[model samples]
Target: MGNRVFVVGVGMTKFEKPGAREWDYPDMAREAGTKALEDAGIDYRQVEQAYVGYVYGESTSGQRAVYELGLTGIPIVNVNNNCSTGSTALYLATQAVKSGQADCTLALGFEKMQAGSLGTIYDDREQPMMRHLLALAELQEFAMPPAPYMFGAAGKEHMERYGTTEEQFAKIGVKNHKHSLNNPYAQFQDEYTLEEILASKRIYGPLTKLQCSPTSDGSGAVIVASEAFVDKHGLADQAVEIVGQAMVTDMESTFADRSAISLVGADMTRVAARKVYEQAGISATDVDVIELHDCFSTNELLTYEALGLCPEGDGGKLVDAGATTYGGQWVVNPSGGLISKGHPLGATGLAQCSELTWQLRGTADARQVSAAATTSGVALQHNIGLGGAVVVTAYRPANR
Candidate 1:
């Protein structure tokens, strides 16, 4: 990497469902892109390259937006990496700056998830392989051929093994929904208790309707510039540097083995976190807030283990103690996460980054964490693969 990359601007559109999948996504994307540019106080023309993140958007979606936004001079690349598509765009944009290919780059995550109901980041080059991989994941998770509920069986087995109560999982639903109540941009907002969550219709095994993230239509964007560029532009005082980032992918699907509560937390997350720790010169204790990938209640339970927030098989303890809550140690999903905030696969990753940046900058008004006494907030984002492709990214405020 060349010196370092800094994020100077961020933008996110309110999650909604009113636009066409392909065309409407671009409109929302342009709105988000303009917001990011304005937030940085830089002209849209300054954006040298654009990397668009979308799990289900059509090909060259980035270019389409650029053309619509009247910025066709630069290269716009489309990225499709399943749920981690947004982060993949961030990673690529960071590289563009770090590699000196561009001083200022645009990293955008925009999608009409409801338009593309079947969630995925498809690449025709290897669609068969990806499909085969996902199908195999479904197969591995179920013994019966072509079972409808691949994740359900694992959820049930996890409850049986860990003695995890339905209430425990429902508490997660309650917390996120409560948090979402304060989020104006969130898609789902209502009050529900553990009993309500349990009483809700079952989507899979132990997973109920309340436990899953809603399909969202939204956009997230950030502008990353090199240290030299920030200094030259007199933007060093306002930029947030990419202190450390670690992204990894697992070949196995999540359903294969539900015995491990930590899942990738122990293997992938630990390794990735350790790498970022070495790079950022910090530990889990130093992190002030974490915006995790909470697509399901059980995922967060396992994350507490994988992220080293608690001992093995004791992730539930962290929740019970309120460690994952806003006022607790290292608040988790202060933005209400995917379940409450809505999970537009493409936009979710950058949305996490945007929320992290705002919290670190202390710009979150009503939902802000007060008295934390930490401007040096450590932000963590988790983006999971369809089966088990998990990518972890961490950040710190550069201006602070």
Candidate 2:
């Protein structure tokens, strides 16, 4: 890396259910991109490149989105990494600055998804998740949506191995929903009691409808710059440094073992998080706030162990002890997470970035993590895709 990359600004739109609004992806993109630029106090002409992420779109959707900012003629690269697409775009933008390819780059992601459980758009082509489906069949089978079963099976395995309970998983939904009450951008902000969560219609295994992320339409963006660019623009007061970031894909362990936990990306998350800790010279205990992928409450629980927030298979105990919330070890998902905040596949990761940046800047007024706000604290992020990929990143305010 030739230069240290810092995020100078971040922005996102309120996450809404699919087709709930009149706006299209381009409109969403423009709203988010403009906010990021405005936050950075820069013009589109200053941006040297763009990396846009989306899963369902026509060719050059990135180009169309960028045009909403300006036809600056900078190179625009489109990225698709399943659910990890947003963070993958962020990774590319950070690299473009770190490698001295550009002083400033924009990472933007948006999605306009269809209602209901996700389905294949290209049924005639080779499906990327076929192998994953095969692995699922080996473990347990379900008649409902494929995603819930994958993560739900992981939760079931954790229960069998470590005595985790259905109530424990339901608590995650309760917590996130409570947190979302403070986030205006979240799609679902109504808090539910544990009993309500448990009583909601079951999707798969112990998972309930309240425990899963809904199909969402939204956009988020971040403006990243090199140290030199920040200095030149006098943006030192607001810059957040990317202390460390790492991405990992599936390994032999994903398939070699029949465990549903590993099959649903536990190993990949563990590896990526370890790499991030190594790069940042920090431990899981150092993190004060987290915005992890909570596509399902089960995944959130699985991730606690994967990220070493607790001993392996003790994720249920971790949450039950109040260790993953505001007054505990860390404030996980102060933004309400995917379960309550909504998961726009292409935009979820950047939304995490946006929330963390605000928290670091002491601007997350309603949902601020108190201890983290009081000190020079670390924020941890985890975004995963099941085909599979995981990105773990560490952030700190630049002055810290």
Candidate 3:
């Protein structure tokens, strides 16, 4: 790295159901971006560049959103990478600081989504997910709502191949919903029993409605700066360094293996995670907290193996052992994950960044990973989107 990159500030709005809030994207962006700037104790003019992420917005929305912050005449790039859009923006901002191209930059993500299961918005053209859809078609019949079917099939395959039980999957839903009870920013904060989760409306395969991530409206922002800038601003105490990050797209096995898990981007997550660990000079065991993509409960189980948290096919065992929750091997998704925290597409990844930063700073209040568990002082984040991309990131307190 040419220069160390630090996240000096972070902020986000409470995730809400698609139509639950009357505000528009600009309002979301302003709230989050303003908070970040205030946290950094810097003015918007200090930002040399910006990368804004969104999935369901029109072109130039990035410029429109940032206008609420300032008209600094800085370069602004709009980014769209499905569900990983938020992290993609953060990745770019990190690069800008690491490459010494900018002393300070802003990564912002926001989404104003429509309610209900996500459907193709552009029906007249070739859909972007056609290839992934074809791969899934080779394995099983298509379900009416595609997301549940896709990830649910992956869970089904894991069960058949590894003897993972449906109860194990439901347990993930229970764990995340319970975790959300402590997160004010989470969309769903109520706790549920494993039986209640299993008995909820079945969407596809082994998945229940409670196990799925709801469409959400929210925004998150991070201010990234070079180490020199952090020192100059006297923000070392609050800064979190971006130690390692990698983004991977679908590999050949995603299509050729005819495995639903691979088709759902497990390999991508594994590859990206491996690269991140190498860059950070640490193993999975070194991570104190995690906020992985749990867009579906099944994906969380699948990701445990992909992230090297456990051996392949042992994800169910890890879950049963309670290895991923508080007082376990690691505290994963203390932010309630997507299943409970809400998945606002573009905002999801940056929201993960915000949570992890708070975690490293020991400012997460009720949901903070315990001091005993956080001795390592490292946090990991995973965010993915089908059609498909995955971004894995590692963070630690800058003062460390």
- Per-candidate clash tally: 3, 0, 0
lDDT assessment of candidate 3: 0.93
Among all windows of ten consecutive residues in candidate 3, which has the lowest summed lDDT? 368-377
Candidate achieving higher TM-score, 1 or 3: 3
lDDT of 3 by residue, 1-400 (tens): 5799999999999999988988999999999999999999999999999999999999999999999999989999999999999999999999988998999999999999989988887899999988888878878888878889899999999999999999999999999999999999999999999999999999999999999999999999999999899989999989998899999998899898889999999999999999999999999999889999999999999999999999999999999999999889888899899999999999999999999898888889999896522435999999998988999999988877
Per-residue alpha-carbon lDDT of model 1 for 141-217, expressed as tens digits? 53321121443444455577677776777788888888888778788778798888899987766678788776778
lDDT scores of the candidates, listed in order: 0.73, 0.93, 0.93
lDDT of 2 by residue, 1-400 (tens): 4678899989999999998999999999999999999999999999999999999999999999989999978999999999999999999999899899999999999999999999988888888988987877877875557889888898888899889999999999999999999999999989899999999999988899999999999999999999999999999889999999999999999999888899889999999999999989999999999999999999999999899999997888898899988889899999999999999989999999999999988899999987666447799999999898999999988887
Of the two candidates 1 and 3, the one with more favorable lDDT, higher being better, is: 3
Model 3 misplaced stretches (Cα beyond 4 Å): 372-375
